[model samples]
Target: RSDPSSFCIISRLKIIKTDISLDGTKKVLFELEDGNRIESVLIPEKNHFTACISSQVGCAMGCKFCLTARQGFIRNLKSSEIINQVIQIRELLDQPEKLTNIVFMGMGEPLANFEAVKKAVNNIISPDALNFSRRRVTLSTCGLVPEIERLGKDLPINLAVSLNAGDDKTRNMLMPINKKYPLKKLIDTLKNFPLHKGRRITFEYILIRDINDRLSDATNLARLLKNIRAKINLIPFNRYDGSPFEEPDEKRILAFQDELIRKNYTVTIRKSKGADISAACGQLITGP
Candidate 1:
């Protein structure tokens, strides 16, 4: 019921849909009652119970490599829209149990719509309802520091920070939110997070060719993550329209990942999946 707040109700009710199968995981996209849309992913491993949910219609955090920003900010989804993404996908895909994992990594900056995101996650983990564990859910953000720290105190779910750059100058260019919060402030907030050192903090670094893939950047990133209990997921750049950025060649990417491992850092190179269907890393949809 949470439609784009600022838009007039004169907007037509149109629905656009898409489905993706990645690494044998099946997902269906749903355009809801509101002008916004959301997606649900059914991973075979989790009995197709995994659903990656979105908290907002369009993203306000305009990451340079993202396609969702083109549609701009619509509105924050209500608790129903967020929960329905799971229900609709199950009915369409015939895998209701497959809606297991709920990730706030889809269309918008989740923390920007924190209350809705919190309500949705609560429904997901509620004993009388969808009934998922906090460990099975993850929330992704573009380094919203104060919000990040707030989540540590409130939510028990896994957290992923879209850490595209190790330094401020590089990050500011890749993600404009950097100009406001900056890397140092982000790190300080992470360090002060209620989660202990042993618990993993996922740093999602999308490797753009010649941008964040160099050996020096990798080393510098490892240095920063050293103090925090971090697991870095190096995501290959997923291209979108107007983004001149290119995914780094595989060999170079492997080398850069190796450099981090050599530095005694826990790192993993996430294979680029669903790019062929335009549902990869930064290719999330905004609306109908």
Candidate 2:
């Protein structure tokens, strides 16, 4: 009765569907006001949880292995939409405060929607908001060079590059953006990024069988990233229907990681999670 119209009410996105995987991964699909949909995944760790959020409804970069790219460009998500993903996921957990990590690896290239993505990051780390640690928040991009440089200048958060291919020709085939920035230029930009002490940029390399999984590819990748303080996350390709690539055998994937370790590079093979529900890396495609 006390001036109800005076109070502001922000509209929340509608949750279209929720699915829990056998591995305990939870995916929530939210419908935007304009009818476009974006999905976020809540991944539980040993004691904490990580929220993988999206920055765009669909992707424009056209990474050959990504399902979101197949949806093409719908539009950039609003900062509110991006921030709401974390909030909604946090609300789903038993110990909400333990959701300690956030990754911008769900649907689109975060750096492509630079301004909104930056605003969302600020809100996520702000004391009045989610109150997340800057170190615990990682933003992934597909090497949008200028935007990447700007992000480094504006924020101290962790950065991850979706570097699926080691060389230009192969990279150009897998990710079209490589043709614009190229490997050398992108590496140079990252090398010059202002990273804090004890922190290394993360490079995500997805290994496709007979494509970018050869030992020579690992050697070239090791050489390319030697100058930069970086750790490698090797993802054995997660395949979907109509997808041309195949995930490498476990032995081949480990051999690739060992080659990097022998070269004195820190590497980890990312275990594919939620494959049954298509909620793993490069698999967040929203259905009509």
lDDT leader: 2
Each candidate structure's count of clashing pairs: 7, 0
Q: What tens-digit string does per-residue lDDT give for candidate 1 at 205-238?
A: 9999999999999988988787887888999988
lDDT of candidates 1 onward, in order = 0.76, 0.89
Q: List TM-score per model, in order.
A: 0.88, 0.96
Residue pairs whose backbone atoms clash in candidate 2: none
C-alpha RMSD (angstroms) for model 1: 5.5
Q: Give lDDT for model 1.
A: 0.76
What's the lDDT for residue 201 in model 1? 85
> lDDT, candidate 2, residue 132?
91
Q: After superposition, how far is residue 143 of candidate 1 from its true place, in Å?
A: 1.1
lDDT per residue as tens, model 2, 149-234 = 99999987999999987899999999999999999999999999999999999999999999999999999999999889999999
lDDT of 1 at 25: 53
User: For candidate 2, which ten residues in a row score worst on lDDT?
Assistant: 1-10
